[model samples]
Target: MEIRDLTPAERRVWRAFPRGRRVDFTDRPPGPERTVRAKVLRALLLTQGAADGEVASLRMTAARITGRLDLKYATVEHPVSLHGCHFDEVPFLYGARVRQFNLQGSHLPGLDAATIHVDGVLRVTGCRVTGLARLGGARISGALFCDGAEFGSPGVATALELNHVSVGRDLYGVGLAAHGTVRLNGAEVTGKVNLRDAVLDAPGGTALNAKLLTVGSNVSLDELQAQGEVRLHGARIPGQLGLTGARLSEPGGTALDVGAVVIGSGADLTGLQAEGRIELHDATVTGPLDLSRARLTAPGGVVLDATSLTVGSNVVLHRLQAEGRVELRGATISGQLNCAGARFTNPGETALRASSCTIGELWLREDSLIEGAVNLRRSQIDMVHAEPGAWPDVVKLDGFVYTALNPRRPARERLPLLERDDDGYVPFAYEQLAASYRRIGDEAGVRAVQLARQRRHRGTLPWYARIWGYLQEVTVGYGFKPLRAAAWLVALLAAGTAAFGLHHPPPLKPDETPGFNALFYTLDLLLPIIDFGQEKAFKPQGGYQWLSYALILAGWVLATTIITGITRALSRQ
Candidate 1:
């Protein structure tokens, strides 16, 4: 760049500029002031011709321009550059058309540039606006840069609003500070919306509301400090939505509400420290949603409400220390949901409710402590890699299905998670266990799990029903043990014959007892519908009567158990 110093003739134009008869400002004796009204300046700019080349360094400072500065509903062909200037009142450029606008290091009470169309970059770097800066519905052909500007008036609702504005290139406000709300709702930016190292404070409500905003590249709020909520609902971000070291604190309210937003890449909140609820409900991310080492705290409420969120890749929540509930109910993650060393501290309220979620792989190992219920009902997962003591006590496993549960523990240790109380011993729970065992190719183990579930279910019944359950299980293994049923019948027959042969008691009436064909006589006593006429003929005097009664009881037990077991197998098929 070549040096283009201000010429002597241009200095004369600056020294001879007239102060207007305005009420907001009065010059010091009007000796050498650069005060001009909008009309006269517009006329002078029109006659510039070739003199515009000499005035490229047309910079002014501490000169207050008089009048309303109304450029609203007008069209000017020339580009304007104002530096270090002071506006007597709020400048109104709403609905105006200008080639380019460069206003840097200026102090203004306000700016109304709503619906204005700028042909090139609109740079307002290092300026301070003490009131509302309304640029809503504005259209800029190039970028808008406000690198170190300060905006907002104290006790106001919104300070900077760009609602429905469209920018052709990037919008940079890297070091901007706003004391009230900064509304970018429905705004469309072709490039990134960079707000890195910004400080926004709106204690009454939302500090930054960018609902329905569209950004082509990353929306950088990294290291942003906000006292109120930051709402980015329904915004479409094609790149990373970076919030790496942001501190958002709204106490008992929402701190970051980005629900229904779609990200082409991912949301990087690697070290986010939020005090209130951070909702990402129904959002979709194509890349990994990183929350590693995040510290989110909302005492009894939800710390992170990401319910129904869909992530194309992994959800990395390792080492997260969330104080309240972290819900992922109905969410779908194509990759794993990792919680290796995370600690959740909301008891009685579900700390991590991932019910009905379809996750590729789940890792809750390495002492990840969730103090409340983990509702995984109807969720379909590839595998759950967990340690022995990693499961919470009140786990809601009703219809929670997984292909394989790689609990790296002994069977005795892992089985307790399957059959614990507070919702225990359902048939689906047995099915889940059987499926897990089958994934490991353990058919015997699968049958053992099914049998264990039946036993625990039997324990839940009344004493009479429990007796029937025990008889069915021990005698025939509830239709799952046919060999055991055959063995039991053989043992009973052998014992009955031996008892009859050993104690050859005579009949109560003289010569009334049947002849001792022990095999045929034992069959008559033990068979349910046999007609050997032993019970009719035998009137035993001593211990034979008691032995006959015991054999008949055993016969009924075995016969009923076998029939019931057969019915169960057929019904299952």
Candidate 2:
């Protein structure tokens, strides 16, 4: 480490280290003058300097460092600042403790700082690394900044690894470009982790793996373009997780997997364009989950699998466009689930499967388009804000319950929605619709829905039962329209009175017979329970006798039908 033995560039760097001055050789051409041995730099870092009471640091610019800068298990007091430097080999800093480490705008083969401890900030901003930037198990007291940095080669398996690493402050990787996967699994960051505008290219592999990562503050990945899956499975973020304007594509695979992830604030994916499935099963978002204007495309497959997802606040999916099925089975949303203007198209399959979901309010606007079947069986929604035109052609509404509906349409309009249920003859669906109408004080709507329910139920009965059902429906609308029964009674009574008046019957016993009044005689024949002396004494012959028999039979049939219909109606209430 003698001054006389130092090369020209090494001598300049050594002289500047004691005073923490920067040696700029960027103006020099690529030769020995601009080159320094990594051994010389290591020796200077580990050597004892004169006690000048000055804050010394190794600051060099545009220097080509040769050999491996091995500092394993070593404690370096001075800060290292090497800007725009080119390293021939990766630095070995395993278990090394340093005050601060910065290699801004440097081009290096790689970095090996596993389990290294940095008292101050660890920055590699704008650096281009051709190999893995391994910082696994490293502990940084300050922020870890990698803004505008490029990591790994095109065919590398892993570009950057920060597994189990602990950072005191934020980890910034804004505008970062990685050719392979960037892993932060099991890493804990006290502050926010921002990777906004990052471009991750790892086709058919995980672009960013942050499984089990714990971030104290928000995690922002806005405008990130990831060619592979960006998984945050089981990650716990106390603050918001923002992925606005992100474009993720793993075609036919998972584009973004946040399954079982817990976010404290919320998740904003407002304009995300994903070509593969986005799995969010069992994820819990404390605040709103906004995916407005997002386009998810995984044709004929599941575009979004959010089964068992729990959102504390509103799930805003307005204007969302999904090509495949969006599954929300078993999901629970504490606030409104707004799907206004959303379009879900998975032809010949279930477009949206939201069975067993418990939502506060479900908003389905008229502009929404759902091409395939929608299964909402067993879902409990507090309110349904939907237009009649918003419903798809096929829906499974068995066990689906809603408190109220918007626009307050009559049952004639809303009844079609129940009819659209692929599971035919769903009495529960019809009853639920009737209950909704009743809650709104729409008595007429209730009657209409009940009448429709009876007609639908009749289709499922046996031949004999169906005939009875059809009779009840035609006569009294299954007791829903009692006025029809009264009309039939009046018409039958009038017809019998006129017929008997035209042909008078002879009396069998003149001594006990009353006067033959046509109205009383007709009433006696029609009313089987009533006793009139005229019907008991009179003996009608030929067609008149047959007319009397027909009236008695009709009377019995009408009485039975009326009684049965009234009993059935009472039981339902």
Winning model by lDDT: 2
Q: Candidate 1 residues 483-556, lDDT tens each?
A: 88789878878987787777654544556665766666788878888878655665555667887888888888
lDDT of 2 by residue, 37-146 (tens): 99999999999463397778999999999999999999999999999999999999999999999999999999999999999999999999999999999999999999
**TM-score top scorer:** 2
Q: Model 2, poorest ten-residue lDDT window?
A: 48-57
TM-score of each: 0.86, 0.97
Report the poorest 10 consecutive residues by lDDT, candidate 1: 17-26
User: Model 1 segments beyond 4 Å from truth?
Assistant: 1-43, 52-58, 61-68, 408-411, 474-494, 505-541, 559-573
Q: Candidate 1, after superposition: displacement of residue 527 in Å?
A: 5.6
The per-residue C-alpha lDDT of model 1 at residue 514 equals 58
